[model samples]
Target: MRIARLGPRGAEVPVVLHDDRAHDLRGIAPDVDGAFLGGGGLDRVRDALAAGDLPELEGADALRIGAPIARPGAVYCIGMNYAAHAAESGSAPPERLVMFMKSPNTVQGPDDDVEIPRGSVKTDWEVELGVVIGTRTSYLRSPEDAWAHIAGYVVADDLSERDWQLAESGGQWSKGKSAPGFCPTGPWLVTPDEIDARAVRLRSRVNGDPRQDSSTADLVFGIDRILYELSQVLVLDPGDLVLTGTPEGVALSGRFPYLAAGDVVELEIDGLGRQRHRFVAHEDAPEVAGA
Candidate 1:
């Protein structure tokens, strides 16, 4: 099943997409959040749909599509998990995972405008496969155990400012990765039963021109291994987001120019859906509360 949220930012309504229509999920849960997922919300939603209890959500197509899940508690990212991406960044594929964190506040609607940080000159884009946690996970005994904790998958754009990430980070990448709206995610949260996750095509474009074109099958460390390795060091709770990493063809490869104001980025992963957003100058961008 495909789950989505649609409306103005911060006031979106949860819904299930089936038969090319949106079915209201307000009666089933408050929002498509951790409480809902960890509390058996999907099962309840399936039952309701089977019984014809969910009402059709009118005007859904005209509304903005918010990130499929509510604000995540944490946004974990894997860097250089793709061999080609590692080579592009001037590094050999790591024997261990290169992980980083993006503040949860970076989350934003899939189609929202992104701000180019003040005085920034190396802003870039990354198209990644995002995994959402459905249950509290810690110390799993095996990699296969990850399946039971996964809620679903979504498309994620891991926007970055390369200057701060490499030159001024003093060794930490989050400095460039944590800007507000740096993470634009989801047109839908597709359940595992509906996608292979291990072998889907993911691609990105800049101003309608192709940039990145790759597949999850190219990942050096697969989904199961990523989750299993993460569980050994930290706890991942429901609604937490894990970006499995982006493929090559980013500006960092020196093949394309970095993003500037007025540039549009489009990203898509087969089955999960697509996202498109524009970059605006910092002064012209909307003010983000508590940013």
Candidate 2:
């Protein structure tokens, strides 16, 4: 089953996407979040859908698409999980996983505009497969155990600013990663049973020019191993998002120029969905009160 949130930024309503139609999910739960997903929300949605009890969301096509799931409790990212991406970044594939975190506030709707941080150059884009946890997880015995804990998947854009990430940072990468709207995810959150997460195509284009094009099959550490390894370190609660990492062909490799104002970035993952965002200069963005 495919689930989504549609409406304005802060007032999104949950819905199920089936047969190319949007069915309102307000009757099932309040919003797509930890509380909903952890509390049998998917099962309820399936039952409702099968019973034809969900109403078609009127004018859904006109509504803005929000991140499929609400802001997660945390956003974890795997770095250089693709061997080729590792090589492009001037590093060798690590024997152990390299992980980082993005502030939950960075999450945004897939098609929202992205802001190039003020005084920044080297803002780059990365298209990755996102895994959303369905239940509280910790200390899993093996990779096979990860299956029961996964809720769904979404397409994630792991935008970055190389300066803050490498040149300025003491050693950490989150400084370059946690900017507002840095992580734009989803047009839909597809349930595990609906799609094969192990093998899929991920592609990205900037201003209509092709950039990153690769497949999840190339991941140095696959989802099952990633989840199992992650569980050994930190507790993953329901609704937590894990970005499995991006492929090669990013601007960071010096093969292309960094993002600039008015640039459009389009990313797609087969079976999940596609997202397109226009880049804007920080100064050109509307100022928020208290921000």
For each candidate, what is the lDDT? 0.94, 0.93
lDDT tens digits by residue: candidate 1, 1-291: 999999987888999999999999999998998999999999999999999999999998899889899889999999998999999999999899889999999988888999999989999999999999999999999999999999999999999999999999999999999888999999899999999999999999999999999999999999999999999999999999999999999999999999999999999999999999999999999976321
RMSD of 1: 1.2
lDDT of 2 by residue, 1-291 (tens): 999999988889999999989999999898999999999999999999999999999999999899998989999999999999999999999799999999898889899888899988999999999999999999999999999999999999999999999999889999999988899999899999999999999999999999999899999999999999999999999999999999999999999999999999999999998999999999886542110
User: By summed lDDT, which 10 consecutive residues of candidate 1 come out lowest?
Assistant: 282-291
Decoy 2 TM-score against native: 0.98
Model 2: residues with Cα > 4 Å off, grouped in runs? 287-291
Model 2 vs truth, CA RMSD: 1.7
On lDDT, the candidate that comes out on top is: 1
Please provide TM-scores, in order, for all candidate models, with all chains considered together: 0.98, 0.98
Model 2 clash pairs are: none
CA RMSD of each candidate after superposition: 1.2, 1.7
